[model samples]
Target: MKLLTLNFLTCAIKACKSSPASFPLHPRDVELEIVESDINLPFLKNILPRLMWAELRTIAAELGLPELPETAPTRDHLVEGKEEAKEGEEVDEVPSQTARDLHRVLLETTVKEGKLVCGNCAHEYKVMEGVPNFLLPGHLV
Candidate 1:
């Protein structure tokens, strides 16, 4: 699989396994926190086979964040694959994601420093220097 996809899956799984108190993180000017605790099955059905709904819900509950409700809100409100509206020199696209989009999302998308975990694959990714420290041990290999 592609590195990004593998990484995202592994991290998501780790988040689901670790204790919330031990979540690793990178603090920014505005701070970073997982917002949703509840999971809306209707909203999640279309994401992909890789997303573990059970894991996601478990992680959210652990973090004390609530997930979205089953109903209400517009369709695709919580879906990924949405692209940036602009395409100019000021903002460049990086593969599937734009540089600005990636930057904004990446900063908000770090595992907690000491207690980081993934909700999908249950793989752990440490956070160091305000960045995710994703190093895989040889056991899985």
Candidate 2:
């Protein structure tokens, strides 16, 4: 699954819902892959506010990826500048380096195989073939 997906995922156990530690499930023995795609600048801008920056940084560090910035980048930072457009014409915005880096980390990076462990419950969620299995047994449910 894409790192972008992990940003919204938390521990599946119902009991762990109230715990802050349940978020940003820790990756273990991960096999990572990079699947390149065109960056949607608008999507990145829209998702910026929803990201748990600190948790994302922790996940990246745990996965041995490069350290993220101390603070999250603002939507304005994602664009370099707008191209001059004629009257009544649409202007194009150029994506900045910050946008590119964000795209690389959130969209390109994938977890091919791994275990996402909950910090609160210590439950392990299996990820196989780039798909995460979050279904819990009756006890966990």
Candidate 3:
């Protein structure tokens, strides 16, 4: 999973600076898109070297989601990082993952108000007061 960081205060400041109606739960300054895929080792191999796990974990925890596992998941494998368990508590590999799984996790699990993260670029979109801040100001890391 591409780790992204959205500084709540920075996001809020940017949002409010652009518009007075911006708020934490109703953010109106960002937009996000989650990409689902089937690529395994190759995909992760390509991006893993570019991310900062610390940044990624911060985003996940802020959203009240479980953290990814400590050991790196082997390619083509789905290790339920951390989320609500189903009746079976098990699902297909392709359907459950971070780096190789789809990015719709956030969109599908909640209302249209919260933080959004890109699974590829690791970009973080802050959604407050029903708005998402997709703006990247400097140092496109």
- The TM-score values for the models, in the order shown, are 0.32, 0.87, 0.35
Candidate 1, 6-81: lDDT as tens digits: 2243343344446543322212222234323334334233333444334444443444444523333222233343
Residue 17 C-alpha lDDT in model 3: 49
Please report the candidate that would top lDDT against the real structure: 2
lDDT for position 138 in model 2 = 75
Q: After superposition, how far is residue 67 of candidate 1 from its true place, in Å?
A: 4.0
- Candidate 2 lDDT over 35-124, as tens digits, reads 999989999999998999999999999999988899999876787753333566655678988899899999999999989999999999
So what's the TM-score on candidate 2? 0.87
* Alpha-carbon shift of residue 23 in model 2 (angstroms): 0.3
Local error of candidate 2 at residue 47 (angstroms): 1.0
Ten contiguous residues with the weakest lDDT in model 2: 82-91
lDDT of 2 at 56: 92
Q: How many backbone clashes does candidate 3 have?
A: 15
The TM-score of predicted model 3 comes to 0.35
Cα-based lDDT at residue 83, candidate 3: 44
Which pairs clash inside model 2? none
